[model samples]
Structures are given as structure tokens and as C-alpha cells.
Target: MNRQNKISPFLIIVACGLVLLYLHGCTRVRPLPGPAKPPTKAPAKKTEKPRPYKVMGKWYQPLPHARGFKQKGIASWYGKKFHGRKTSNGEIYNMYGVTAAHKTLPLGTYVRVRNLKNNKKIDVRINDRGPFVRGRIIDLSYGAAKKMGIVGAGTAPVEVTALGRPMAGKSAAATVPAYMPVDFYSGNFTIQVGAFSNPDNAEKLKRKLSRIYKNAHVVNDLHEKTAPFKVRVGACSTLDQAAKYETRLIQNGFPDAFIIAE
Candidate 1:
């Protein structure tokens, strides 16, 4: 009986090892998580596209590109009359913004306008449609006009030069010129060769041009008493055809020939 009651040393060591393994397994627990991360949000995208619209019973389409575009004409500005209104681009008109209105320029084109009277120069972004009167070309915001000293005169003769599209970001837009996209819409078109206030002279030009081309006519604006009668040549089905006629007219004699939508 005394020999059976005594335990082996190997058995005692094995029992102690099993007890330790059980305790180690019981103590093992999942690790605690750290701080949570904030959820991220995505940015909103803005789209710019060319759209045709009508004003005063007339239709106008924006140009696809302003590359190498230059014009000399009357420039006017709007203050309270058009301020707070929606521009052609869908942006609110801010009289204080360095922006402008052009009848045919692309909505986002950047142009340099110089006042011929004072030689004051200002860079403006085209964002709206214009000084719709015949002789006028562009309409400026109050701030732009002020910068160019045209606010006091109400109107000024100016030279506008296309600077092309700006860079991707607003900060770098003025410094870098980007891509020039051409989006031409082909339809019935003509080239205006000359304009005269006197109907007789306009008729004379029309008769002379009619002998050379199948379609040559005088367009007289009946609404405006002071508006000039315009003499145009050729009847083109596409803008490309009108452009070809424009080149021919320019080469022949008419240096001021330009395409006009019919």
C-alpha cells in the first residue's frame, strides 16, 4: 500500500506542464482596436458644353474655338440692368467679376481687350451673350469696364484678341494656354463684304457683286434707322463653303469679307 501511494517524478512533471498550458490558453484574449478613421467624401463634378439659344427673336450659337480670333468693334458694359441675372453659361452675373459677354465666343474663352481710346488693357473671360446691337461686339462687366476706364463713357472702341482656353485650375488659367477644340456646325451661310449707310451705294455694291456671283444681296435692318445696309455674296449650304467663298472674295477685292450666319 505505501509503494502504490507514491507518484513517479516524470508523471508529476507532465501534470505540471498540462496545468500551465491550460492557464496560458485561458489568459489569451483578442486585442483591442485603435481609433476609428473618418469617412471620406467625393468631389462634385462641373460640366461645360456648347448650347444654342435665342434672344430677341434671333438665334445664336457659340463658337467652338477662339484660336487666332481677333476683332475690333464697340464694347459696352452693364451694371444694375443685368447684375444678379443668369448669364448664358448658367452662372449668375456678377458685375464685379472680371467677366464679359460675347455673342459668338466660346463660354470659357479668355480674351484680352484693349480700349482703343485710352489704350487700357484688361483680360476678361467670356461667360454670357452680348451687347446685341449691330455695331457692338462685346459687353463687359462693371468691374472690367472700370478697370479699362470705359465705365464713364458707357461704350468704347476696343480690340479683342483671343488668348485661347485657360489651364485646368483657375489659379494657373491665365498663364497657360490649353487645347483648342473645333466644333463647327454646318448650315446655310454667307459672307458680308461691305456695309454702307446709303442705300444707293449698298445697291450698287449688290448689283456689281450679283453680276459675279449667283447670290449677292443687300441686308437692310429696317428697325434701326441708323443701321447700315450690308452687302453679302454667295449662298453656301455649309460653313466650309462659306469659308471658301470668303477666301475668294478676299482675294478678288473685298478685304473686309467675313462669314455670317444666315
Candidate 2:
């Protein structure tokens, strides 16, 4: 019995040792992995383009003294091509006259034009719109260019200076009244409204005010750097009407609305 007991204990120990070896073989251990890396990318490049030349957007600021403002550029002339045509201001154009075309200066605005090639200068009134194309600065009437010696040159470099008032010796100064304020009427009473841009906006405002006031209308106000369609609401025939509308406009917005008599 003693011998059997000893053998049994030995066999049991051998079986446990085999079981431990089997467990160690079956439970495999994977090697610890290193951290993964992120992806790399390439950089990109940029390209640029060239711009065109233009002058319409440049000379668009109001001058302190119309006489003080001056500019240099190519000048040309027009004749029978534009004769008898209605100007932007509704005035008839007489190409033989000494009137001049400016990009934006007010109609009736007088400017001193100098032909750089001949050194001859003449004062001309801005009576029409033009030099509508690019590269040219001023467009003079047939007689204006002839007097300034630009007709012979075809196109000449010139300097233009605003005269504030009227041309001293031009026909516009002699025949056409200088600085005549446009008449605005409120019934029998007349008031002048300043210029505005966006004629449709003016028309819209005109209709809105017309519903409330009798003398509402739109007027063309032309000036250098600005051509506006102004909405004149109500022709106040009396100070009372003007005063009443002025108060109403202030209450309805447009706190700056007022009346200027002609």
C-alpha cells in the first residue's frame, strides 16, 4: 500500500507539469507593436494675372475749387458727327460752337483747355458727354479744337483746368447763361433738388412721395463725377407747405430732407 501511494503522488505531479507546459504553449504572446506613423503630403504653388488700363474710375472726385483741378491726357475733337444732337443735359449740341465734352464735369462747367503741342489754350464750357471711349480725356467741338490747335494734330496731349464759373471768352460764356440754376416747381412755387445717381431709385422714391405730395418729380442733375436723377417730392408753393413736408420727411426717415427755393 505504501509503494502504491508514493507512485500515485509522482504520477499526479507529472500530470500537473504536463498540463502547465500545454497551457504555456497554447497561450501564445505577441510581440508588443510600435506606434503607427502619419501620412506625408506635397505643397502647392500659385499663379497671377495682368490687369487692363482705364481712366473712367480715376477722375471721379469733386474738386474744392473747380479752377484748381487740372489733368493731362490725350484730347480729340468732334464736328458734324455730333451736330444738332441733344446732349445728356437735353440741350442741342452745335458742333461748330466752342463747347467741350468732359467725362463728368457738370454741364455749363467752364474749363481751360491747353494744347500741349501748340501751347495754345482756350476756355470751353462742358456742354456734352463724351470721349466715351477709352484713352482720350476731353472731346472738343470743331471750333474749340481749331481754336486750341488740336484739329491739325488729330490728337494732342492737353491739360484741362476747371474755371469754377464760366469760360471767359467762349461762346458758351457769351451766349449761354453761366451757372443758371434749374427750376423746380411745387405747384406755382419752385424749389431746386440736388443731383442723385440711380435714376430708378429716384423714380421709385418719386412715386412713393407722389402718393403723399402733389409736386413730386424727377430731375436730371449733371455735375463732374456725378450724374444723378433726383426725386423732387412736392413743389411747395408756400413756406407753410415746405415746412410741413420737411417735418413729415424727418418723421418718415430722410432726416436731411429740406427745400431750396429757385
Cα lDDT listed for each candidate: 0.80, 0.66
Candidate 1: global Cα-lDDT? 0.80
Worst 10 residues of 2 by lDDT: 58-67
Q: Between which residue pairs do clashes occur in model 2?
A: 104-224, 105-224, 106-224, 186-235, 196-228
* lDDT for 155 (candidate 2): 86
TM accuracy, model 2: 0.42
Q: Which pairs clash inside model 1?
A: none
Residues 59-88, candidate 1: write the lDDT tens digits: 455555445677899999998988899998
Report the C-alpha lDDT of model 2 over 1-262, residue by residue, as the tens digit: 4555355788999999999999998997977888776666566654221111124543221111233456799999998877998976688888878888876565667777988888998888787767866788899999898888778777899998776554345444365445332222222333323346678877787777778767888877453247457566666565446667766776877654645442
Task: Estimate TM-scores for all models.
Answer: 0.52, 0.42
C-alpha displacement of 162 in model 1, angstroms?
Answer: 0.8
Candidate 2: where is the Cα deviation over 4 Å?
1-67, 167-262
> Residue 165 deviation, candidate 1, in Å?
1.6
